[model samples]
Target: MTGVEHEPANERYAYSRTALARLALSDELRELADRAAAGVPTTNDMWAQPGEVVGDALDLVHQAQEALVRAVIYERQKHTSWEAIGEQLNMKRQSAHEKYRDAVAEWQLALQEPHYPAPSGAPVRGLRLHEAAYAPTTAGARLDAWVHEHIPAQRETEHPVTGHLPALSTAEEMVQVLDALNHLYGDSRTPPDPKARARVIERKAALLDRIAVEQGRPEAAQQAEEARALAAQLHAEAAQAPD
Candidate 1:
């Protein structure tokens, strides 16, 4: 893993230091503002306090979300096959591929985007965030927190569609890209082999078949059939190939 993929924090510890730095900086700034405002007294909101169990837990959730997304990014960069990734993730190959394919593609686009110097003269606008703005107007369940995000009573059901999107490169090219990414991100864990992966898929299908029969779920049985078919194909492919 790149030690400090994000500024002022290291990924080795999942950016805990960086999150703390942000919290401390925010509190200092709030206190300074309180001293200047005269009417506004500085108060330690639960969300802003260091060593608060709930705050740390929330920050950890934020860290985990980012890490999960980045893990998908790193895996894609290595050009790891969806099957292997799925095997490791304990999900169907298609499910894993479908879940992360778009997000990973977007991340690749972002990394390719150009960087620019920060603008001067703006101390900061609003607050530094540790997680996705679940409620834009709220201070996130703090005692003094207020909701800023307005939920309209009615919203449009749909919008105009966009242009056709690009596709991931060929499998060979994707693998090459992943290797390049691995150089930067550093991959140490081994992915599942074809035989092992096939077995996993087969076993899952077997379980699904049993569940389908017992639970009387036709859909589950259909999915089981599909999984079995895929597993058989994978076995055939592995038998013909050299590891």
Candidate 2:
């Protein structure tokens, strides 16, 4: 991976689930608003395709409902109690828990087994279901870019809608991203193939070295040295893995 691929926090190379859920909620709400604002066709024309129009509206409503569920999941992620969520949804706390507890359980289970084996002989070690389904890297970048393009004014304000977006492309975040990637992909100590693993470690080292330089933090520099040492060890291990 090119360390340069991620730069400037606003360009966002990674996203937390909360951000993705918020974006999904906002999108569904916008669609509902647009549909509501679009006035119905005049009498004779309205009768022409009533079923189609009503069906489309029904679909939008369903999507918006699901989006609300996802928004609840985001709140749960932040440790908001069922009581709080139920109050927001205008329901009883027990009702809210019953409605969303399964989804929340599934989310927790996915995190536990973050990656599943790909079909035989796939290039990467495995596919990450949560990453693919909920928070793909591409989704993060595109969502950030969409906001910047469509709602330029958001950049200037601390509006609740746009505020609190993570700066995952920043130097500090890069280190965390690498750490997460390392854990998700395989154990760094005994990866099946070291050639690719070594390269990633090297990139992490380079990023740390850069952060150490730009931020005037010697600790990061020391970490970079440690990372490089690991990379060197991995490179040596590569010879043992058969082609």
Which candidate's lDDT is highest? 2
Q: What is the C-alpha lDDT of each candidate?
A: 0.45, 0.61
Global lDDT of model 1: 0.45
TM-score of every model versus the real structure: 0.28, 0.55
Tens-digit lDDT string for candidate 2 (13-91): 2455445445545555555655655635455554557487677678778867866876786688667899999999899
**What are the per-residue Cα lDDT tens digits for candidate 1 across 1-243?**
111123322111122222222322333333333433442343645446465646545555665555565555556655668888899889999999898888765544333221222347644332222221112112112212211122132122121111111222333333433443443334357644556457556655765676688778899799889988988988998899886
Which ranges in model 1 have alpha carbons more than 4 Å from their true place?
1-52, 115-243
TM-score of 1: 0.28
Predicted structure 2, TM vs. truth: 0.55
Q: Once superposed on the true structure, which residue ranges of model 2 sit more than 4 Å away at CA? A: 1-17, 31-50, 92-94, 102-217, 232-243
